[model samples]
Target: MTEFVRVLLPLAPAVPLVLALLGLLLRRPTSLLPLAALPGLAAAFVSPTGEIISLPWLLLGISFRLDPLGAVFLGFASLLWTLAGLYAYAYLGGKQGEGRFCLFWNLTLAGTSGTFVAADAATFYLSFALLSLAAYGLVVHERSKAAWRAGRVYIVLAIFGETCLLLGLLLGANAADSLLIDDVRAALAVSPWRDAAILALLMGFGLKAGLVPLHVWLPLAHSAAPVPASAVLSGVIVKAGLIGLIRFLPIDALPSWADTLLWLGLATAWSGILLGLPQRQPKAVLAYSTMSQMGLMVAVLGAGFGAGVAGTTMATALYATHHGLAKGALFLAVGVVAAGAGRAAIPLLVVVAVLGAAIAGMPFTGGALAKLAIKDSLGSGPVGLLASLSAIGTMLLMLRTLVLLVAQRPPAAVAHASAGLIGPFVATAAAALVVPWLLFPVLTGRPLAYAFASPVIWDALWPIFVAVVIASPAFLRSIAVGDIAGPVEAVLRRVGGSWTAWHPPRPAIDGPRLLTRLVKPAQSLETWLAGSAASGSALLLVAVLLGFAALI
Candidate 1:
């Protein structure tokens, strides 16, 4: 029974993907959204605990394990995917090429869920590749010039990330002589190549997670994708890299590298805030916010790595679960507003505010719990201070998001949103609020009541206060940061103008001349060598040279 559940758990996400393909082929793509989420939902509830199954003959003996960490991420990711799926149903109704979107959507879902459950290097890589590539379809669904450009940037960065991960996985497999995560981790704990492996893994997964410098594609991709795609892309897909980092990096074995990661994570956290401030589009702003939040997650993982691997897995998983749900809710709320659901606007605003607070580590939200769970690991020094500042940065970003949300209201007020849309939005918001509280005690081994204490609550509130205070002047002064890409656009246009001027088009050629021109002197020489006499002469010359050399 346990083994069956383990195998079925991995297969569960694929069911919806298959159904989506069938629906597309049958020209009944409307049903594909709900169909895509069912397997993920079932797996979340029915998969047995601590089950491990191996298939050595397939994909280098890939393994699947339903451990606590995997279960937490899988459960939340599945749940969010379901909500996004339902939201997509109504949001994309009667839209053209939605069938294609649904197909890619389901494929990405399957890959993300599979990544969480996969126990071996090969399985993880397979899932990672699938998720990354399928997401490209989502990014470029609009097929506009901007979307195309965004897609190009996304693919290039994604390929770079994959190469890094593949090399790391190879090193890991070679060191351990096993592809399973547990064995590789165990091997890394004592191996001399630990630093190299961790660095490779960080670069690969960090790119996906939108760590600094590698984060260039995230804002562009998220802003260009359709609403539902953006929701899942920002909320869920990026977390795959976080899961990879948690699973593969030998956190317990390398404190020095871990500290380095923590510092880098700090830089990432601030970089997003610094870069995000200048954006006008709400989606682009949110994209940068996602980058910032991902940086915080990286910081948490770095802290865990520094502290040793004992509790890091569970801590990172809990943090990721909270982030996945809250971020999904926030993105969905953005979609609701964008759709002109004005009557539902204020309430959604409130919900978004709460979600934003959670991202900023407001007391009693999932974010606070996540922070507390990993607080000890981060320790009290510059690292902790930097971690605390991330909360402030989040607060600033969220405040900016709120101001933009209110300012960008449609010229005409809209009626309430459909149940299909509002239902998932509300469900995710409630989960973001309540689920973390329930999970916190189990994850932190502390009383839930500790969260409400004055000191803890104050710690959470003051950072938000500071952020608000800092942002108020900027808001009042009408100091707009503007778009970062604007300057680049001017430069590109200038270069394009110069190139067009420097190169003039040639006149059309007649057929014979065109064919002759196509075959250059080098090509004619190659063709002549390929003829029978030339081939025989060339071979004879080579044979004679060999004979002369032998005789000498």
Candidate 2:
């Protein structure tokens, strides 16, 4: 690496983090949030594959590297975050809590960017922790009852995921007898506790990636967050879990594990569609769309890994990039329609149609490229056919989502597209349209001509046609967003209400008052511990314990 690139590597994540603190002091509007992410974007372009930059002075001798996979993740993620940040300005500029939102937004940006580059386990964990924890602010930025509830579920699941991840990392590192990420991943295959480590990793990263049963928090969190936050949560943040699986799982060394992931991912893919079909909220449907898309990503990962395919990382990264840009744009488009894009709502819907097609892998779009990148690994057997059928389900979901969004469009006379939303939204949409063609050849080393072949085009087109034919208003159902958690939440609420309605018979609170007075100080301590900042520290403590559990 050149001296310039070497210096630029660490600065990518560091710059935004420093600016985030400064922005907090300055109290900038939401629009300025995009400026903080600029450096990371610049680094993305110059990130040379196989380049490494070490900072021995940093926490436990951290190192950063830009391999092919890292480069793709960093570049596209930076793009999504920056655009989403600008869109946030339009969505919530000068609003109350804008400062807090900006802080956590940039902090999450730093954390995610760091995760893409870190070469050491400690650096990766810290970055992942920052990404996981700071995002809570975004989830609850509105502070409404729903937002708080979502925040609670998100933080709990986040802590759980991180705990599993931390323990897995520790086990891998201990087995490797090295702190380096590559060393630890290689050692996982040889570890005495290999099965336990892999289980921990799947539980942790699987939760973040929204794989099947672990996806309870996702739909609720996305629907509860603000538009821009939901965009990142779905598009950029989930990729953190994906990259974890790619970087650490050692798929080539353990084919059985890859097979396990294959089935798990397939289950998530189908389930997300089934559950999302019933969602009333547009964002909730998109949230489930994200879960399903993530399932596709992992499914591809498992197939490629099991096949011992070269360049699986790059191909998976390519798919991720395509999905991120398109899905992020789709979410922003929801905001535009919700804002009553006036005359533009129709035009925006046209764009949404095309975006949805891209997501469903229609011919001549980025999604097609993504599908092509992973096609060989999925093989031509039943597995491949089943995976292809997922496209039909995805298209149907998007079709329903479109119907919901159109229902939301305001009357032309009363509606007008907000100018601020258009710029970022268009940029994101354009990137999704254009970036895949640029990356596919480089990533997969395949000619673009393959994507346009008649067979390929027909294969992509049939599912979409089927989806259209099968879609009907009569079939739509709005199952409350939380899936399995829905009934559980209802039970808890019912029980709590019952307790409130039937207060236990209290003895003349004279004696109870004395008891309360004695524990008032304890209550005060409890209150202190309940604050958000304290909760975050407590999260870290839990991770440490989880790691220790692995060692034992």
Candidate 3:
């Protein structure tokens, strides 16, 4: 029975991989697309307790596992993929790039699901790399200039992140003399270069998680991808980094750099909220919100590291699971709103409001539960207060997302969204609402009474109340902070510009004036060469010498 359960771990990733390859032969949109997620969803239930399965014949000794922590990630990843795949069926129907979309979609799905199950360093790296690389195709699927530009930025950052992870993994592996993740982590506890390894891992995973300063690619990439692709990319793929932080970082032991991590996480969280405020685009606002939410998760993980509590890891994973589902559903809702109009748009907008508000820690939602789970970890320190304040920011950001989404109705001439599109959208939103409630008991071992209790409910509601009070001014309500990101982004851009100005590359110089100068010299040389018999004789001599050398 155990072996059968473990078998599903590998099979989970295998399903989508096969589908991605088969997409090449697919003549058109087919019903078979969403089935790719079934295996993973099955594995989530079958291996909730997790079992380490070895594949000695595979790669020197590749291994896969399904611990409870990994199961949380796998469950949400599978659910989001299934819903997104369903949405794509209708979303991409009659679309010009359906084939390209399906191929990349399945590829990304395989990599994301596999990342959670990888038990060894090599397998994890391979899985992470696959996810990073394959997602680019989705980012650029529209083939527009903006899409291509976003893809370029995404690939560049992804490659840098991969390099950091590879080096970190190599360093840890060398210290431990083992390829297994468990062993490497054990070795890292006492390794001489442990801090360096941690720093590298943080940089690598933080980049993927859209941590501030490394998050430039996120908004551009999320907004550029197709709606379904954006949903999963923001919701599921980014969690790869969160899981990395969970697995690699020593949550059970307090490290010297724990404070630094906590600060970094807080910065990332607040930065997202501040930057997301000005955006008019619903998708972009949501993208920044993701960055903010990820920052909070990072902060929670850092808090766990500081406290060295056993439950912190589980809490972090549960929080991530909740955020992943809700965020994914909201992105999908962005599509529904775009397709809806007049009276048909009302219910969808209401659902969107509830879901968006949930991210703000609205009462009786997954976001509220997520906050409760992490409360103990955050503790009663200044960090805790800051974390609470961050919720207000989240509320403000969600308000912007709601307004943008509501204002995005299709033209009067457009048709109502087909059932195919609305079906997945509504299904995902329902899951976001109900699934978290069902899993709360399993994840926290806490009763529904605790979740709905007066104190916890009020704690969740206050932040939202504060946000509304602040935004009550009519002008302030419409204020968007997205266009010129807050102080952090402004500072980053200034610093980057200064660095570039200080060290401009000669070979890659641009501007028509410089080009004209360089081209004029080249043109003059060309004319001189054409006019001069001596130059021609010299060229002929060089060619003759080269020909002679070749003959010899």
Candidate 4:
């Protein structure tokens, strides 16, 4: 029974995916969206233990492990995907190409769920690749120029991240002489390539986590994607990278690298907030906020790394799980409001504010428990100071998001919002409040009361208060970066015009300009021969002959 449940746990996410694919073939995509998360829901509740399903031919195997860490991620990721799936139904009702969106959505769900259970390098890579690539369709679903451009940027960054990860995994496997995660960690602990492996892993995963300097694509992609897609992108897809960091890196073995990770994480946390403050779009603001939140997660991991491996993993996962649910709910709220669910706006806004504060470690929320869990790891240092300030940054960003939501609300929308939209939004908001408390005691090994102590509550509140103070003048002034579209469009036009002007037109072979333009047959033939298929075959044949002759 346990074995069966284990197998089903990983396959659960795939069921929705398979149904979605079937829907595509049958030209009945909408039916698949709601059913997409059924299997995952079952898996989360079953709490299956480790079960491996090998596929030697594919050079990979699936393993479902329901350890506390994986379970925390899988539980919420599945829940969020389920809710987002339902939301997508209403959000995208009557839209053309629902089939394409559903297809990518399911594939992403499969990849995300698989990542939590994958025990080997091959399985992890395959799942990571699926999540990364399938998300491209979502990013470009609108088929608009901006969507296409955002998709392009997303693909480039994603592929780059993949390359780094592939190389890192190869190094990991080579050092370990086995692809199993436990073995890899054991091997990495004693391996000579530890530093190189760490660097590769950090770059690969950091890109996806939206770490600074490599995070340029995040805001653009999130803002451009459809609402449901944005929710999953911010909520689930980014967590895959966090999982990768937690699972792959040898946090136990390297204190120096851990410290370095602490600094890098701090940099990412600040960078996201600083850039986010200048943005105007609600989705884009959320994207930067995701980046900022992930940075804090990375910091937690880094500090945990410094303290000890086991604590770091547990604490990081706890923090990530909290962020995932809260962020997912917030993104879903963004979509609901945008779709004209404004009647419930006040309560939803309050929900958003609390989640935002919770992110900043507000008392009684999961975020505060997460902060308490990691406080020991980070210690009372400058890293702690930055961590505190990050919460403040989150508060400011959320406040900005709330203001934008209020300003952008349509007058008519204030009175009517569909129950279909409101239901999931409310459920998610409620989960955002409740689930964290349920998970906190188990993950943190601390009493719930620890989260509400005077010092802890004060610590969380003051940063938000400071941020509120800083943002008041800016908010009152209606300060904004103004429309960036005009300058960007003009630059694109100029670049296109220049390319046209610089290119010489082809002349007819028999025309007056043909003689000057045409190449000599001997030269042209030589050039063509060097690049031609026949020439390439000949070169290959010659190389083979030379090798044979040498062997003789």
Clashes (N, CA, C under 3 Å) per candidate: 2, 2, 6, 0
The positional error of residue 41 in candidate 4, measured at the CA in angstroms, is 3.1
TM-score of model 2 (CA atoms): 0.89
Whole-model alpha-carbon lDDT for candidate 1? 0.76
Q: Candidate 3 on 1-552: residue-level lDDT in tens?
A: 866776888888888888877877877643557899888899988874646777788667767898888888898889888988888888886678787788788888888887898998998998899999999999999888568657856776788788888989999999989888888888877889888888888888988998866776788899889899999999899999999987886645645566777888899898787767877788888999999999998888788778875577788887887788888888888887787644668888888888888888898888788788889889878989999999998888778788777667777578877788889888888888887788777777888789888888988999999988886322232223222222222333344557769998466356778778856754453443342222233234433322332233
In order, candidate lDDTs are: 0.76, 0.83, 0.79, 0.75
TM-score of each: 0.85, 0.89, 0.86, 0.85
Better of 2 and 3 by TM-score: 2
The residue ranges of model 3 lying beyond 4 angstroms of the native Cα positions read 1-4, 472-552
Residue pairs with backbone atoms closer than 3 Å in model 1 (clashes): 56-61, 278-482
Residue 51, model 4: Cα distance from true site in angstroms: 4.2
Instruction: State, as a TM-score between 0 and 1, how close model 4 is to the true structure.
Output: 0.85
Which window of 10 residues has the lowest lDDT sum in candidate 4? 477-486
Predicted structure with the largest lDDT when compared to the true one? 2
| Residue lDDT tens for model 1, 130-215 | 99999999999999856876786678668777877888888888889988888887787677787787778888899899886667
Per-residue CA lDDT of model 4 for 105-213, tens digit only, reads 8888888877877778878888899889989999999998568667866786687778778888888899888989878877876788888877888888987898765
Off by over 4 Å in 1: 1-4, 56-61, 189-193, 413-416, 473-552
Q: What is the lDDT of candidate 2?
A: 0.83
